[model samples]
Target chain A: MLTSAAKTALYGAHVSLGAKMSPFGGFLMPIVYTSILDEHKAVRTAAGLFDLSHMGQLVARGPAVAEWLDRLTVNRVAGMREGQARYNIFTNERGGAHDDAILYRFPEDWLIVVNAANTAKMWELLQASKPAQVALENRTPQSALIAIQGPRAAEILAPLCGADLDGLRSYHALRTRLADGAGGVEVEIARTGYTGEDGFEIFLPAGAAPAVWERLLVAGTTHGLRPAGLGARDVLRLEAGMPLYGHELDEDITPLQAGLGWAVRWEKSDFIGKTALAAQKAADDYDRIVGVVMDGKAPARAGYAVHADGRRVGEVRSGSIAPALGGRNIATALVAKAASAPGTRLTIEIRGTEHPATVVPLPFYKRPA
Target chain B: MSQPADRFYTKEHEWVKIEGQTATVGITDYAQSSLGDIVYVELPAPGAALERGKPLGVVESVKAVSDIYAPLPGTVAEVNAAVEDDPALVNRDPFGEGWLIKVSLTGDASPDGLLDAAAYAEFVRSL
Candidate 1:
């Protein structure tokens, strides 16, 4: 069964129109909006607006909130100033990544947005980790996030929010009142996006989101904004060299091997999985993530085996023939050093047929002008 | 968008433009619309023998990979190279510049089995 939460990753999910429905992140999300290629192009050449309301939102406060958060997360939270956000990780004691989150620091507290499927578990962990003075609350039902992304996204969204958008930069957010009597809503416009374009993610009240979206659609028509689904979002993020949670990193993949070591605060006084990560970093038998380009027409979608010569070398983590890259089969995979070099020759078994493949640098497509 | 009257189509949406023993091949407008923004096509090599209704090639869209079927039996005499370079041509010109392959027909190339423009339009509407 596809729930509302399953719909975020690939927008257009759970539409009553009988499109192929797949359960993703606890919601039913669309793999294609009309068609994957068209949607992808809309984002690449024009602009794409995605409904990312299904991501988890949590509020933690009190004296122990900060301290408890520091003990639980991989990234150091002590340095976060008000109105700032930082990417952090939830890790197991063995150093494997459980999930990733964005920590938004408020003047007196913090809002941690996490993956939909991981929300309950993360909340439970916080419940156990919170000190006597701390309080944790899950606010997923109250918030809806909409992303307006592409080269011309800013120009399209400026009038609606009436913020100083010209000076707005990436990773920065501004909270402001939305339309009058607009369902008791307040919107936080973040100059952040998943499509690797200049765009914004607007966070508003769940009830108010639809109205704001409608207004944006009317306002964004001149800029060619499309209501893109999750399918296009994946291709765009992959093209930009960003990683997906389940595809690139999971409970089995550590932050170090996933090329997310930069997010780990090694110098922090103490944090979960720090010792294990330190030990893993000292040794090397595990694989690291990198891009792969397969030859010929057949693309190696997820769950395909990577082969060196005729033997299994590794597994394809994420795979797609990107639209912007002119239909070349590209992927990210973790493999042993013998098979992980940039120029290493390999093959991917697609439907029992072996397609010629090669290891390439991360990101198959650069930002198009 | 066109559905040339004299051509036959497969359930997979391939169109065969027949002329005596020679039949030009391309995907239908419906197929093009369904596939959307063709990025790369793996066409069967020239002179490769293909059976009717069999997998002849593959098409990669931005989001998914789809297989192409041979609409009629014959050998591939020519494959569109322009599309290999610029797959968007398939979306822009599905009938002319977007044509995929040319095959030499062995025997039957049915005109009765194919839909006229009106019929194809109805087929699309029904879909």
Candidate 2:
């Protein structure tokens, strides 16, 4: 029990053995000052602050910025508006997903926040694979990221950052100040989040993050912002039916096969893998991605087999208990063409047992109005 | 709290109580807390051989799937069926109704390979 020291120590009271807890992302973090379920429920109802400093950010600059990026990514980055952000995929020439990124364009350079797990590999790929003219630098060491997300997120962040965030619209970003400083590093706050809840990803120097974290926690306590960890982050994204990169989209799978074809700018005249993408589109034989809602008590997990007529049809790529949509099991699976349609009945193998399931439209959950 | 002083513990985080040759086994409090909420537990059959340190059954929580290792080698076991239905039994009564199975001790229920409450407490502390 984490509460072990509190009841035992008399002066451990003053010097309570604050837990050195290690958890998600290979870091020991606090599970809760309270409980896991309580922290999970808070984000569903109100707002929560998460230390997402582990996520990686890369800056791309130099002469072939537009031309090289447009070629390297599946999405259209060349036509991106200033201060706007877009979710795009970096892929191999074979069209497999190398990384899923949020591309941010500023006046000086373009920044892409990538999943932390892919940081090293993505850097190596960019150095070896991206055009010779594009200069890609890993800026993760210098910055930290924070997510203040949920229904009241905008309201909480608005007064502190002092930017017209309401008018900023979704997927927009701007350079904003915390305490009015001109001689030092600046913070760039973006309206981006891994959680489906509306939120902002505030970027600042790594050394200055703890102060901001403390301030936000103090400022947010009045607004019911609990300090949530990666556990709640997993549940939130699962409920929102968002796909995690390693789980849903991987190096072996193409974005088109993962139901992200709409993001590929085929209308653009040229891009990397354009010839292969065109051929795949012409073939149209890809086994597409779809959502599966389980019909039994079991939670489907990664590598669990998806079944059709007692035969293994596919495997669950990512699965979890959907917190927002009650306690039912939800999964994203890559099933065959016929079974990929909504309303198609399927089965999920949990452990050794097969439970009835069905193909549903993407996103088993959506934000309430 | 540290491991209860009166209880004996297996290295795999299982705690046991033996009366005669029949021994009761359940996950330690530290195990349940680490596994988060216990969502499902697979209990062994009434007459199956289980070797010490070998997996006797499976326990799936919201966070991870764990192999419930045999506390002591034995044969033919009675299971706690309640956990199969309401798996939270491990969280609620980890030492009582939360017991996974009763095993008939095989070799020595010897003290050498096991940990006392003080040692288990120290071991968990090091973790």
Tens-digit lDDT track for model 1 on A235-340? 8889888878887888888898887888888888988888998998888667888788878766677888888988898888888877677767789888876887
> In model 2, what are the clashing residue pairs, if there are any?
A21-A28, A21-A29, A22-A28
> For model 1, how big is the CA root-mean-square deviation?
4.4
lDDT of 1 by residue, B86-111 (tens): 88799888878999999988756555
Candidate 2: list runs displaced more than 4 Å. Answer: A1-36, A62-64, A127-135, A179-185, B20-22, B45-51, B73-78, B102-112
TM-score of each: 0.81, 0.86
Best by DockQ: 1
DockQ of 1: 0.36
Model 1: fraction of native contacts:
0.60
Tell me the spans in candidate 1 whose CA falls farther than 4 Å from its real position: A2-47, A117-134, A155-159, A162-169, A180-184, A221-227, A293-300, A308-311, A321-329, A343-360, A363-369, B1-4, B17-24, B105-127
